[model samples]
Target: MKTITSIQKHKGTTPLTVITAYDALFASLFDQKVDIILVGDSLNMSFNAKPDTLSASMDVMLYHTKAVCAGAKETFIVCDMPFGTYTDEKTAIYNASRVYAETDAHAVKIEGGIARAPIIKALTQNSIAVMGHIGLMPQFVRSEGGYKVRGRTEEDIVTLIEDARAVEKAGAFSVVIEGVVEEAAKRISEAISIPTIGIGAGKYTDGQVLVWSDMLGFFQAFQPKFVKRYLEGATLVQTALDAYIKEVQERSFPQTEYTYQK
Candidate 1:
């Protein structure tokens, strides 16, 4: 029953586990295993077949957040503030407040760093918990010229550290460090009192997160190098579909075994 703030306070001493869930089943499945469940806007790419997170909206996020929160009875749910929902302090607070009121999420995550500090502060001050996201934010995919690693140079590292500090100062309970150098993530984790949840950042992070679809091999087109497939669901689902088709063609389905006896 520990709050996200309590978890952040004891981060390094106790590693946190996080994962993205777009619906009820996955959220229920991962609830026990993960310390946090993010109703991520990555659903646009993972579910709706969009190229990236850009097409996701507040309504889409709210729909999924509600589903995930319904299933995640015990886990702390963090809803993603989708693209274009929070461009400034006033808008950020308004949208974030709506999300808090509508979803069962314990917090809201916004991508950016120093530039978003005011918005973050405003949300936190109004009693909505905030989780900061930095490094390879998907909402910035078009601006960043596609997905890429960050903090390769000294200046970039410095900027990342500053970003982390700013997020902490803005009163975020934790921050996600995505696709950044391991050393940089580690340094940031150490520097901030708030926890650092990493995705493709490395093992030294306070916690790690991955898209549930990617981890379960539901997406067959491509997989990130950092994602490890725990289940080959894509191939399995295809095989099942093929079997059903063959059964129907041969009239093998709706057999006595599957039919209800009078």
Candidate 2:
């Protein structure tokens, strides 16, 4: 399990590995296998079939974080502060403190850059560990008209650097740079002292993260260009199910070895 100090020390030495898990089952599978496990709000889409992550409430996030903590006891866990829960400094502190008190999550992640720096600062000042998220934030999906990849131009890259700096200044142990241009992502990683975890932001970051369902090919609705399917999970599961159904129909499932003679 990597602590805040160890995770930050890994900035330029080695790349970190992060993956999202929504429950205890998968978290247990990934325990001690990855650098960090984030209980991301993206669960709303992949788990509940919601259109976006905005509807994920504090209760929902807390519930999932607790479950993940239970499964990944040896792994460092970060819980996401759901949208609208951290609108102000006071609110941010209250909600972030709840994460520390209510669960074993090591830190809390929040999306934003310079604009949200003060809130992040307040939380950190209160001894809360934070992980900053920049570039294309999913929380702003509807406000931005849709998910947009940032850092196309030189100006955008400069702004990204500023954002990274602000997050570091706000005392975040790390930051997630998502959905950005590759070159820009590299620049941002170089500009920050903390580790930069990339998701769809390319290989130049200090680390990479992916939703478990996306990488495992479980979510069949839509595939993002960044997600590399490691396994045909859905197909494999369906094929196994079909075999089980056939066995049951043919009265071949319950063999002598599987039953008690007495």
Candidate 3:
């Protein structure tokens, strides 16, 4: 399990690995294998069959975070502060502290850049560990008029750099840069001392994170360009299910090595 210091120290060294898990079963399987296990709000979409992460609430996040911690006791976990839960300093502290008191999560992740720096600073000052999120935040999808890939232009790259710097200055141990152009992601990584975890951002970040279902091929609704499916989980599971149904329908499943004849 990587600690805050260890995760930060990994900035220029080995690239860190992160993946999301919403339940104990998968968290146990991923335990000790990845650098961080994020109980991301992505569960709203992948597990709860929701359209986006905005509808995920604090209760939803905390419930899953506790389950993940139970399964990955040895793994470092980060709970995402769900939408509308951290809109202000008071709200941020109240909610973030709940994560610490309710579960063994090592940190809490919040989306925003320079604009949320004050909130981030407030959380850190109160002893809450924070991982900043920047560049095409999902929580702002509706407001931003949909998911937009950032850092495509030189000006946008500069803005992203500033966002990265502000986050670091606000005392974030690490930050996630998502949905940005490759070169701009590289530049942001160069500009920040804290570790940068990339999702759709690109390969040059200090670390990479992917939703478990996306990487394992379980979520078949759609595939993002950044998600590299390592397994055809849906196909394999369906095939197995088909075989089970065939055996059951044929009454071949209970052939019985020998049922108790008492």
Candidate 4:
């Protein structure tokens, strides 16, 4: 089982692989293959049919985390603290405690940096492991005015590196650099002591993560430029369903061999 310490150890030695899993079924598939199974709030769009992650509530995240933890007993699980839950240290610790206590997750990932450094420190000081998130924060997308690549400008790149340093200083076991320019993400990865996990942030980071649906082609929604579809899962499921429907309509589904013997 990969713990926070193990993930930290892999920083310069090897690149880690992380993927999102919203339920036990998917968790079971990649539990042993991947280094970490994250109960990401992207499930707002991936599962709840929401336009963004802001709609994901604590209850919804917990429901999925519980399911993931149940199945990935030997794998390290990280739960996302959904929007409106990590407002302050007290609140962050309160919510993080429940996540660790109830779901059996190994750690909690909180978005933001510098500004949230104190909150991260509080959680870590209280014995809760934390993973930091920077760059294109989905929770702030509405205010950030939409999803856009970060670290395109000098000021933005500097801020990103500063954010990485701040999170590292705040005691995060690892930090996720998302949707940034490849160069900037690479620089940040070098600047931080903890492992840097990238999501569309390029190949230079210590680890990589992707929404499982994006890589699997499980949904027909917008595809991001960074995602490489490895399998047409949606099409395969659709074809199977179509065949099932036809066989049922043609009254061929209940063959004699499929029935119970008298």
Pairs clashing within candidate 2: none
- Alpha-carbon shift of residue 208 in model 1 (angstroms): 0.3
Task: Assess the local accuracy of residue 249 in candidate 4 as a C-alpha lDDT between 0 and 100.
Answer: 100
lDDT of 3 by residue, 149-185 (tens): 9999999999999999999999999999999999999
Over the stretch 135-214, how does candidate 2's per-residue lDDT look in tens digits? 99999999999999999999999999999999999999999999999999999999988999999998888889999999
Q: TM-score of predicted model 3?
A: 0.98
TM-scores of the candidates are 0.96, 0.99, 0.98, 0.98
RMSD of each: 1.4, 0.7, 1.1, 0.8
Candidate 2, run of 10 with poorest lDDT: 6-15
Model 2 segments more than 4 A misplaced: none
Query: Per-residue alpha-carbon lDDT of model 1 for 185-206, expressed as tens digits?
Result: 8888888888899899998888
Instruction: Indicate which candidate wins on TM-score.
Output: 2
**Model 4: per-residue Cα lDDT over 130-211, one tens digit each:** 9999999999999889998999998999999999999989999999999999999988998889999999999999999999
> How many residue pairs collide in each prediction?
0, 0, 0, 0
lDDT of 4: 0.93
Between prediction 1 and prediction 3, the one with superior TM-score is 3
